[model samples]
Target: MGCASYVKRDEYDATIAELRANDARHDQRLDQIQATLEKRFADYDARFAQFEGRLHVETTAHFAYGKAEVREADKPMLADFAKTLAAHHEGVLVTVEGFTDPAGSASYNKRLGQRRADAVRDFLVSQGLDADQVRTVSYGEADNRQIRPGAWGDDGLANRRVALVIDFVEAVAAR
Candidate 1:
């Protein structure tokens, strides 16, 4: 317990300048991280969308016709994605939404869609993301959702994909 004194002008100025310098360094570091993340997203052709007050990172992993397995080439991208998302962002809920081409009965396609979503969800979990944080859904040959509507077989390759979606508040806030 000692006598209190007001902060001197010079001392206050110096403290503020130091704080500003620290803030600048923090900003620079954040900028660097942003640049790296942007490049990574571009490499995977990932894009962002917002709706219903949530932000989503929309990227797809395609599967072969009548198959739910994730392709070998897509695994690396998804693995890195899992590592990055789990490492940086907390409280992220990923919805592995699956789709299928219109080549089978509606019920069969729906089941196939679900299998696709589950496969991606499992893959992401295997890649290190918490299983509890990822969920699965199936659109099941929704015409409007199709990249090439009513096209099945090889032409429907784009349709046979699971679109990984992340709904995170921090992502929206940062934007």
Candidate 2:
């Protein structure tokens, strides 16, 4: 009986030892899983930060005129538009484009169109925007407004205005 009792005690001790080893292995695996999850979360956080930094917005505003002359009332609108462009100066650019009607010679119209763009560019510069921040271009007698019904009397006036082009960094990169 004594021998049998001693053998049973020895078996019980071995079973407990094996169970403790198994538990230790399971604990180690749990710790590894936790570490992996933490690493993934950190990686995701960094990616999201990069995405937020790259995010941007773009908008276009139009200013029109008659007889190729800018209206005094349009001053405020132009200023506001300039401000909008300034807001996007970080990784963004503004294009001041001028257009003219088909009434005059293409060469003359091109020069006039350039003047219109230059005027807008100068105004924007005066309002605290950098001259380099805006680019001026002219499209003479091109990009006219289409109208089929009525006789286009002074299509030149509407064509003789400046158009704003706001481009963001991401958009430029995509192109």
Number of backbone-clashing residue pairs for each candidate, in the order shown: 0, 0
Tens digits of lDDT, candidate 1, 89-127: 666678889999999999999999999999989999998
The list of candidate 2 runs beyond 4 A from truth reads: 1-69, 143-155, 169-175
Off by over 4 Å in 1: 1-37, 169-175
Question: Candidate 1 at 156: error in angstroms?
Answer: 0.5
Clashing pairs in 2: none
Per-residue lDDT, model 2, residue 129, is 74
For candidate 2, write residues 1-175 as lDDT tens digits. Answer: 3554445888999989986785565445334433543343342211111121121111122235324455576666566555644553444455677766665577986887788778778888887677766778887667443112222244434445566554444444545
Which residue pairs show collisions in model 1? none
Which run of 10 residues does model 1 get worst, by summed lDDT? 25-34
TM for every model, in the order presented, reads: 0.73, 0.52
